[model samples]
Target: MTGIFQANRALLFFLTLAVLIALSSVVVVDENEQVVIERLGQPVRVINRFNPTGASGAGVVLKLPFIEQAVHLGRGLKGYSAGAQKVRSADGQDLLVDTDVTYRIIDPVRLVARLGSTAKLDAELASALPAMLGARLGPLSAAAIALPGNGGAAQLLRGDLDARARDLGVQVIDLRIGRVMPGETALQMTYEIMQARHLREVDAISAEQIASARQTRAQVAAQAAAILQDSAGKDPEFYDFFRAMRSYTYVFENPDAKNPPTIVIPPNSSYLRHFNGQ
Candidate 1:
């Protein structure tokens, strides 16, 4: 009975050990995840939804407990903002460009073998992406990159980067240019040029307004002269009387005149007839 009890205890211990090892060996890869199994620091297999090894699409992979490791990477698209970088344009203008890249790990085995970790991959990209961007953008003028509706330069940049990044086991989905700004000197020059253009526009508008005002003044003067001529033609005597009255009012009521001119006229003159109630 004692020997049988000892044997049963030994069996229980082995079972517990086996259970621990089994639990450690089993890897559950979710639908959105891809796992790279490495044996002794070398990648052996990648299990993902595309390469489903189980019924539920949640890949259940197994590896040796102490000799293998599972590296889980997201199969979903990942975004990395490369941040702002200084690049020179073809027209010799320095531009500060903010950019981002969207990519996915296309070949997990190659990615594991090359970069080893996402952090290392990111580091590699951070260095290589900007260089690639600069290379593509170097041939583009500042206006080409800074223009609002033009996307050809950016598309070219994405194409070049995608081609280059594929070697790193990443498939570039999209590349975006968030902001493109000129350097300090270039910005100031642009502002000055814009200001000069606005000033010229304002001057042209002002000149046009002045010419319009002169034309309106000439038209009004011609109209007034025509009306006066028509009135004079209608009644010559009344026109003379009105002119005399206007001259009299101007001479007497001229506030700015320092001295009044004395006019000698005969007592029976027509100019004095109205004042004399004749």
Candidate 2:
């Protein structure tokens, strides 16, 4: 019985020791982050916590148990550090612009020291970005803000953001202008201008069509009048002969009829002289 009790005690002690070792030796690294293990406040191991099984550049690493703790860092494109801002143009036009920024962890040490975490950096960017954009855009006109520079608003905005975010530890790779809208007065003015231009274009087209139609009608009437005048001028005798033939057609249709067309005959009528043989 004494030997059995000693054996049971040893087994219990070994099991306890195994449990402690298992608990203390485990470490977890997420897929989209990195870990910096510190030993007594000093960096002892840097574990890239981004994609443990993605590639083989830095394999899954281990550290001494209970001697160090890991600090996580971002591995891929994190969110912007800034929020949206409202700015006014040189023309006193108010514009609300939402910008999205793209960045990565370039200097982890500086990033950690400055922002403490990816979330903090994102917040800082969100706040700082609007101010920077507003400051730069303040002196610009409405046309300038809406159209940007010769390269376009996007290029101008990108250059401006790149210049501003240089010292913020995270590089501003790209910025997007999410939404653009005009204020009440400006929109009204724009509508009025468009309407005026449309009315002018319509009037011009209508006037052109009216003038063209009038000119075509005048030319047709003038051509008809000219043809009649030319025929009278070229053959006066034929004109008279045609008139006589028309009158004869009406009068001769009813011979010896009273109230017939009275065509006055001259004293030297050729038909009467031939019949008398004089």
TM-scores for all candidates: the values are 0.59, 0.52
| TM-score: model 1 vs. ground truth | 0.59
* lDDT of residue 35 for candidate 1: 84
Model 1: lDDT to the true structure: 0.81
Per-residue C-alpha lDDT of model 1 across residues 159-215, encoded as one tens digit per residue: 877777788788888887878888888889999999999999999999999999999
Tell me the deviation in Å of residue 68 in model 2. 1.6
Clashes of 1: 0
Give the Å shift of residue 236 in candidate 2.
58
Candidate 2 residue runs with Cα over 4 Å from true position: 1-32, 49-58, 81-84, 148-168, 183-278
| Reference-based lDDT, residue 225, model 2 | 72
Task: Give the per-residue lDDT of model 2 (tens digit) for 1-278.
Answer: 98898879989899998877666565566666766676766665556633425652244556666776656787777655233367787788977666667766655555555655566666666656666666677787766666634125555677666655556555666766665567666678989999999999999999999999999999998997787578779988556565556656776888778866666778688534433453
